[model samples]
Target chain A: MPKVLMKGNEAIGEAAIRAGCLNYFAYPITPQSEVAEYLVRRMPEVGGVFLQGESEVAVGYMLFGAAGAGARVFTTSSSPGISLMSEAISYIAGAQCPAVFVNIVRGGPGLGGILPSQGDYFQATKGIGHGDCRMLVMAPASVQEAVEMVMKAFPLAEKYRNPVMVLGDGLIGQMMEPVEFPDHLKSEPTNKDAWSTNGMDHRNSKKRNIVKSLFLDPALLNDNNLQLKAKYDQMRSDEVMFEAYNTDSEYKGLVVSFGTMSRVCRTAIDLMKADGIEIAMIRPKTLFPFPEKAVADASKKPTCTHIISVEMNMGQMVEDVDLSVKGHLPVSWYGKCGGEIPTPEEIIDVVKSRIA
Target chain B: MQSEVMFAGFGGQGILVMGKILAHAAMEEKYEVAWVPSYGPEMRGGTAYCTVVIADHPIGSPIIKNPKHLVAMNGPSLEKFAPTVKKGGVIFINRSLISFGANRDDVDELAVKIMEIAKDLGSVKAANIVALSAFVARSGIVSMEALKHCIKEEFSNKPKLIPLNMEAVVAGEKAGKK
Candidate 1:
C-alpha cells in the first residue's frame, strides 16, 4: 500500500480502526483532539461507535462499560485530561478490563501549557491510578511507530486482560509524517466471549461472567491483588521492549531517553560522534516494563563512564534510569518543561558539560 | 541529502500549509519527511511557522534550530529567521511584504514579489503557493513537477483553484529562476 502523509493523532485513530477496534469514546483535548475528531467522522463510516463524552471521567467509564461488554474500545487524552480519568483508570485496571488509552502528553503540574512535554511519565509509568494496578505503557518515538503501537495495543491489552497505554508527547501528536499501515499488524478481534458480559444465553453456558472491581472480602481482594501482581511480573519478564543505537563501540557516555526525546538524543549522539566523542543511546519503547536490563548493561560497558536521562519533563524518567544503573555508574538528568523541547545542539551541550 | 526548510509569516498567510505541501511532495518523491508547526497560542493572531525536513534517510528530529532554507513571508519573519539559516543556506523572501534583505553575506538570498504576483494572478490567497514555488525553484529541494502535482492534489476538492495556483507557480518560478 502506498504511504500517505498523516499527523500522529489521525494516524493513530486510523490505525486503531485498521486494528479492528470499532468503539472509541473520548473528549476533546489539545494535541490529541485530532484523534477524536478523526474518529468521529471515520468511525461512523466504518459502522463503528464514536461518542464525545461530557468529560474525561465519563469517557473513561464509557470505555470501561464498552470493554466490559466485550467490545474493542479505546480513548485518547492529554495530561490534565488523563488526570481526570485516573480514578476510572484505576477501577478499570482493578477490574482487569481490556482497553487501550492514548496519552498525547502536554506539560503539567496543574493546567500546564498546551505544548508537548513528557511530564506525565511519572503519572503514566508509576502511580497512574490508586491501588496495585499497572498498565502496559508503550511510548512511540515517531509517527509510524505511533501507528504500529496503536495497532498492536489492542491485542496486547486483550492478551494480558489489562489496560494498555500508547504514550506520545505533543510533538508526536502534532507533527505530520508519511506512514503506511503494515498488513501484518492487522488482526481479527480477540474472542471476548470467555469473560465478556454478554448474556448467559449469548454464551450458551451455565456460568455467569461478572465484571466488577469491588471485592469486599479481605481474603478475596488479596487474591485478586495477587493475580494482578502475577500478571505484572509476567509482563516485566516477557514484554520489555527497547532500542539501542551506537552501542557497539566504546563510549564515554550513554544517554537514556524515550519517545520524541530519543530522536533529539540521536542527533546529539551524531553531533558528538562527529567531534570524536563516543556517545551511545538507549531508547525504551515500553515505559512501564522499562528496558532496565538494557540500561544496566549499557552502563556497565567498559568505555561507558557516565549515564544521563534526557526528557521533556524536569526529571521524571531519570529515576527509572537511576534504578537501572544502580550505582554501577552515575545517572545525570537534563530537561526543560512547559512544552519547551530542547534542540539537538542543546543536548550536545548538556552531554559535553556532563562528560567533560 | 537533506533539506531543512522553515516557512514563517502571519497566522493567516498559509505558512503552515506551505510547509505541509513541501512535506507532501517530499513524501511523493519517497523521501522521509516531517512537518512540524508552531501551534497553540502563537497561532492565533501571532507569528505562524512550520519546519519541514526532507531527507533520503529517516529524519532524526523534526524540530530544527538552524534550517538550511527559509521562506520568510513578512518583515518580522524575515528579521527573526534570516540570521538562523545555516551558513551557505538559502533564504527566500517575499519582497512584497518584507522591505529589508538578509543581513548575512554567507547565505544565498532570493527575493520574490509573491503577494504582488498572486494579486496580479487574480487571488491574493495564492501568495503562499507563489512563495512555495519560488523556494522550490531556488533551492531545488523538490522538483517543480512534484510540487505542482502536490499543489493540484492539495486543491483537488476545490478544482477551480488549481489553474490559478499553477499560474502562480509558473510566474513565481520565472522570477525565482532569474
Candidate 2:
C-alpha cells in the first residue's frame, strides 16, 4: 500500500470506489459536498453509478431503492441535510437494508453555521428516525481513518443486514492527510442473488425474498426487536475501539473525548505531560456501541482520579460518557457550541483547574 | 513530538498554496504531514486558513489553535492570530498588505513586502508562493532544496505552469534574503 495525500471528502469517495461500492446517491451540502463532487467525476470511470438526486430527501429514497436491491449504496450530508434524510434512514434500517451513510457534521439547531461540530452525537447513536432500529455509527478522527472506515462500513453493514453510518464533522471532511489504500480487500460484495430485489428465476421457486420492516403481527415485531437487540449486543462485544495515552503516569485526571476533540485532547496531553500533571484520553471510534467497557474500566481504575468529557457540542456525547462512568468517578463536561473547536491549551487549563 | 502551523489570508493571496508547499517539503523529508484548507463557501472571495502539520513522529492533532508558527498575509490575520503564536515562536508578516507590525515582544517578527516583491517580478498572482519562499528562506522553516523539490512535485501534474511558479519561488527567496 502506498500513501497518497488526500482530502477527507475525496478520501471517502476514493475509498468507496476501491471498496467495490458500485452505487452512490447523494445531494450536495456544506462541508460534505466535496464527497459528492469527487464521486461524480470518479464513479463513472470505475464502472460505478453516481446520481445527484432532486434533494437530500430524494437521495435518501434513492439509497433505499438501490440498497433494497442489495447494491452497495451510500449518501453524504451535514446537519440540516441529515435531518431531511432521517425519515428515509429509519426506513432503510427497518428494512434491514445494507446502506452506508456519511454525515460530515456542521454546527446547527437549524441551518446553523458551517463550521465543524460534534453536536449530532445523540442523533447519530440514539436511533435518529424511530421504531426499534439502530445504525452502526463510526466516528473517524483523521482523513486516513475516514477512508479506511468508509471501506470497512460496507461489509459491516452487510454482515448485520443494517445501515452503517460514518459520522464526521467539517474538520475531518475538509482536512487532508496521507492514506494508504489496501491492494487486497476480502471481497464481500452484496449478496445480490440471495436477498436483492433484482429478479426471481428458476434458481429457487419455493419462496420469494421481500425486504421490508413492516410487520403486521405484534408478536412478530417483538421477535424482530429481540433479534435486533442481539445483533447490537454482538456489536457491543466486537466493535468498540478507543486510543489511550499517558494513562499510566501519576495521572491526576482523564479527558474523555471523541472525533476531532480527541486530537485536541492529545495535544493538551503533550503540553501538560512535562508539568507532571499527566492526562489521558479515551477516544471512542464507534459512537453507536459507545465503547462502554473500555471507558468503564478506565474510569473505575483507582489511579485515575477524575473524568471530563470534551466535545464540540453542549454535552451530547458527554451524557453517554456519564452513563458509562456513572458513580465510579466524578464525570464533568466541557465544550464550545456552534462549531467552536476548543484548543489544547484551553482544554488543559480546564482539566488542571477542575481536577486539582 | 509533532508541530502544526496555520497560514491564513484572503483568497488569491496564496495562503493554501503556501501550506501545500510546506506539506510537500515535509513529506520529502520523510516526515508525517497534512494540509487542510477552508474550502467551498468559505473559500470564494473570503478569508482562507489552512492547518499544516509536519512531524518526525506521527501527528496526533491536526488542528492548531496556538500554532508554533504563524504566517499572516493581511492585517486581519495578524490582528486575529498575533496573541495565539506560541511564546518564543516566530511570525512572518507581509508588510505590503498589513500596516501594523507585530507589537508583542514575546515572539520574533519579520515584516516583508511579499506582494511588492511578486509585483516587481511581474506577477502579483505569485504573492502567496513568494511569501512561502520567504518563509523558507528567512525563517529556515524548511530547507531550500526541500522547498524546490516540493515546487517541482506540485507542478509535475501541470507541467506548463512549472516555470512561472518556480520563478515565483526564486523571487520570494530573493526578497527575503535581506
Over the full model, what C-alpha lDDT does candidate 1 score relative to the true structure? Answer: 0.90
Candidate 1: regions farther than 4 A off? A184-188
Off by over 4 Å in 2: A184-190, A201-207, B38-44, B104-106
**Tens digits of per-residue lDDT for model 1, A1-356:** 89999999999999999988889999998989999889999999989889999999999999899888888899999999999998888888888889999999998988888899999998899888999999999999999999999988999999888899999999999999999997744344456766689787776457677899999999999999999999999999999999999999799899999999999889889878989999999999999999999999999988877899999998989999999988878889998988788899999988988877
Stretch of 10 with least lDDT, candidate 2 chain B: B36-45
DockQ computed for model 2 against the true two-chain complex using alpha carbons: 0.60
The sequence of per-residue lDDT tens digits that candidate 2 reaches over residues A1-356 is 66777788999998888888878888898888898889999999978889888998998899888887767888889988888999998887777778899999999889888889998888999957888778899998888889889998988988887889999999898887778886534444535555567667523434477887888899988887887889888888888777777767767788888888888888789889977778878888999889887788777667777899999999888788888887878898999977678888889889999888
Question: Could you list the chain B TM-scores for each candidate?
Answer: 0.97, 0.90
Model 2 - which docking category? medium
lDDT of 1 by residue, B19-95 (tens): 99999999998899999988876637799999999999878978898999999989999999898899988899889
